[model samples]
Target: MTHSDTDTLRAIQHTERERFIASHPRSMALARDAQQHYLFGVPLHWMRDWPSPATLFVAQAQGATLTCADGVGYADFCLGDTGAMFGHSPPALAHAIGEQAARGLTCMLPATNAAVVGGLLSKTFGLPMWQMALSASDANRFVLRWARAITARPQLLVFDGCYHGAVDDTLVDMDPLTGGTLPRASVLGQVHNHAAFTRVVPFNDLPALETALKQGDVACLLAEPALTNFGLVPPDTGFWEQARALCREHGALFVCDETHTVSTALGGYARAHRLDPDFMVVGKAVAGGLPCAVYGFTHDMAERMVQAKNAAPEGHSGIGTTLAGNALTLAVLQASLEHLHTAANYAKMLDLASVLEQGLRDRIAASGRPWTVTRLGARMELQFMSHTPRNAQDVRDHAQSELEAFTHLFMLNRGVLLTPFHSMMLVSPATTLNDVAQLLAVFDELLAALRALPARPATAPASRSA
Candidate 1:
């Protein structure tokens, strides 16, 4: 890039920094070179969340912090979007990985830890059988396929604005007119018509769910106990009982994706709340920041699911990955189950999250701002609106982008970090009280600054009231 172009980019970035500044020269310089090789300027497109010029290229992460290229250290509340929710490179997880590297990696064979982990899962989730996958998305896909086969049903049901990690069956959206899935306009290049195979209903609406289920073609109801991606919309009281009852009446399997909400308790929100889903998926931090994800089924369901699959023409089912259930991963899972993710760890995390959420909520109220913080397990989010949202659309309608960017940058600039996405924050056992206080202090400052800003302009395209 020419000096003039570089200077122009810098000028635009200067304007952005005037608007958002989590960067300090070094991050910008690094971003310039990175854009030449990597797409969207940073290694990952989503890393753009750090600040105006670019994301602070991370040098290393230890415990609950980020060491950036600019030599600034930040308290990392993002925690790799819960991928490192147990705290980055935890000792037990690391030791297990190193030990397992020597013990041999992948084989179609099961490690002795497999049975132990299975029992642990059964104890934690109240589900008797467990299956491993490389990611929560993959596990969800396999679960849906199993559901389809066992029930011999063609239609799948997911909540509106629910995210199940890129599985095709779960991608179908609500048709604006028919109010049913319609090869979702956003769905692209799919060989199979997902609309024909999927249905979406407003969450927490038992009548809506029952109406759809009445068709009798629904295979499974895939959902997060709490919606995270579409902003953390928790279900209304007793919503689960009503929804589960509807599914039972409809003969649809209930698959709860506790990938994010599992941080709620050792068994996940489902077990904690006594909601008995046919299958439960807990991922992201299950193996203590390693690449492991799992799904569990009740004993009867597991037997039937396996039989249904075996009764099919055999080949790779496109379900399991080569490195999934590898020795290193299993060892990590074993160590994680034994040393981390314990009852004590969960209690600590949930308590810290409660503190953080209360602090933010108090600060928001003190600022006289229209915002509220909500918590589910160890995950808590501060939605930028006065009134709480009831559903995804309500949350989306009230989202405040400028306010979110401002708050995120404000936190980064002050040495506290939060998730890049506007939706959430994660708390791990390793997160300290001082660290939580730091975040609250930063948030207090951001809300104060936002209060100083002039009235929202009619031209402001982004919603900041989320």
Candidate 2:
């Protein structure tokens, strides 16, 4: 990419943004009306982050498509950013939630379905004990408490560019220049320094990980099977094997956060790869897009946690919320585990994802663009670089924000929705080959527009001053 090419892309994005506002009068009006009551004119502040001129108000969503307030249907590859990864409003989940709604929503007491769900979870995830929370953020937070309690250590080890929900400790990133941990600058309203107890290491770097653990201070190593937040960066071959060994050798608990990587398999990537971890978490889709997150533990880990709990003076464990593990959530989880997360459904999702991956690669090749595509089961991401990124710096160095904005807006105008934060696309079991083909066709148009830009002498990107 050149300066001229970037200017041309920005111009195209401006035109697309205008086209969106002109076409979506209903959504624009709704947004204007909502501004009086809602922050940033939307229920969630992040909704305003989309490249569209205004937030799109979804009238309805089902399967792999959603209708906006303007009555335009879009092939919804975003899938609520993997919260609806299985599919929107799955029939079994809908029925279960409806029935549970009449019975009662949330009671402090356990429901009958809780036992059944426990059995299914143990069978699927290879963990003997489980706990619940309202979101992956809560689950990760609660588990970190348990980790510190059991290991009696003060620090946590996390990879650079990793995202484990909004947990405060995991928000720290490695400062590239000084190689020191720093709280991510994007996080809002932080008053305390998080780097004191959080050790940051780059993904796939075994030596750095070993050196960090050798300090004998980390209580746990919290990680995802693959990096999906900044972009999809898969683990190198045999990476987890050595990483797990190092954690165990250093007496630190190993935890895998599968909130996004749950799309990889019925039991998530940890079970699929036989990577033994003391704790594992699955959220978002676990309760059919409802607010529920489950963290599981191995038998030994469970025993250690029990001992920690027994030793504490009884007040509050600082673990659960009032709405955690409600009857409605358990009912939905039972239905989803039984029907939605089945092997057959996953096969369909994986097949569709393969089609999507190949289609994007073909389009990139045809356009003569130095772009690449990476897939993890049902999830895939398109990076504006020639190869998969190896670490966080690789991701930053290769990112083309202007190009991403233009591509996202282009797809939005053509009744397709990619994830707002990145060029990530997810394929559900309900996604058809025709839908994939349609997305590829629009992608071809985007490429053609990029190729039409006049060539110019390329200038090197300026070096960072700080």
Candidate 3:
């Protein structure tokens, strides 16, 4: 881009940042005080990652709207990054949680709802057995141990740019230039070398995947149905079928993480697409925004898990935590699955997302910019590239950090919110057509402003390091 173009973008970003601060005085005050208590001026470090000049303080959130501390309401397309995907405080889940809390919270012992939840999970994900965890990260970690025990292998294979939570092993990324696995720079306090045991390959590349699996030392191929982290990268045709077949052929378990893709359907992407995964994980919205996750496996995999446990030394087994499968979590998870996570609700979400997808496409077209939108079920992302990215490297090669930041800040200032970390937006059962239209209208204005910038020759792409 030219100097004039850079100046225009910076001027727009500055104006938006000032507008946000001027409107959210209460939020800025709270953040100023919070800085003394919280390390990053927020409870969680990721909360600081939003595009706002200061961390926006939430007063309350219900359905698809969130009111900030300054009393400004926003159409919350982010939805707590999928933890609130079913919508905040759904009546059934809230009631279940309140009742369960009155009785007890955590007891290390199984609750009466355990058997019912297990059966529901089996039917939902087409798996025979289930286990619980506090989060998707825990489920992924435990499943990795089980996979290693079952396959007697030490290495775990994951596609590039895939995120399976904060699992130390899964945090490794494939170096774009060298095509070698390395620990992601974003991961902090790392004591172990994850690349030593975590094999990385590009998604949608069957030749690379086959070569990695043929090594005969992989315990499991952990992946999402699509690459969702660095914007959306939907799988190519017949990708899962061939990948699952290769996993079976190489004596490795195909572990599908549906924490994000559960929005694909009530049955999750694995069952929705008819892909046979040896193990499946569903988290985030599984318990209606509660801190809970579940992992399930096929009957054969269950038997292998039992055998592996029995054959091991009588000890911790390094699988589950004491607070896992607590009474409160089981009750809420059961309530969410039976009441909120239903086909009817998903149909509504899908319809709204379709509307959003087309609106984004129309807006992008009007701008005459080389951009594309990708969708997987109710989730969609707008990428500043000419076409959909096939892998993480492709995403990095076309990433537009400054453009993303300006767009995010502009939208947030206009009482709309997209996922701050990316250009992704999700439609929940509670998200209305009006809310989506509002977002698109704001985006249309922003695109028009961006389109006024002077065009220039292309330069080398920059990664989103921050």
lDDT against the true structure, per candidate, is 0.79, 0.89, 0.89
Give the TM-score ranking, best first. 3, 2, 1
lDDT of 2 by residue, 1-466 (tens): 6666777778888899899989999999999999999988888788887888889999999999999999999999999999999889988988998999999998899998888999988887789899999999999999999999999999999999888888999888898877689988878898778889999999999999999999999999999999999788999999999999999899999999999999998889999999988999999988769999999998898889999999999899989999999999999989988888889999999998998899899888777778899999999999877889888777877767777778888999999999998889998887888889989999988888777664332233222100
Point out the worst 10-residue segment of candidate 3 by lDDT.
Answer: 454-463
* Clash statistics: count for each candidate: 8, 0, 0
Off by over 4 Å in 2: 453-466
Residue 412 in candidate 3, Cα distance off native in Å: 0.6
* lDDT (10s digit) by residue, model 3, range 77-134: 9999999998988989888988999999888788887889988877777888999999
Q: Give the TM-score of candidate 1.
A: 0.91
Off by over 4 Å in 1: 1-23, 49-51, 182-192, 454-466
Backbone clashes, candidate 1: 8
Question: Residue by residue across 1-466, what tens digits does model 1's lDDT show?
Answer: 2345335434543554654343477777887898899888866566775545466778889888888887888888889889898899999888888888888888889887888878877876788888999899899998888888899998889988777886888876666467777554555588887776788888787888999999999989999998887778888999998899989988999999999888778878898998899998878888877878999998889788778878889887767788888878888988887888788988899898988888887776666666778888889888776665677667766766655665676677788777876657899888999999888877776655544353232122353221
Stretches of candidate 3 above 4 Å error?
454-460
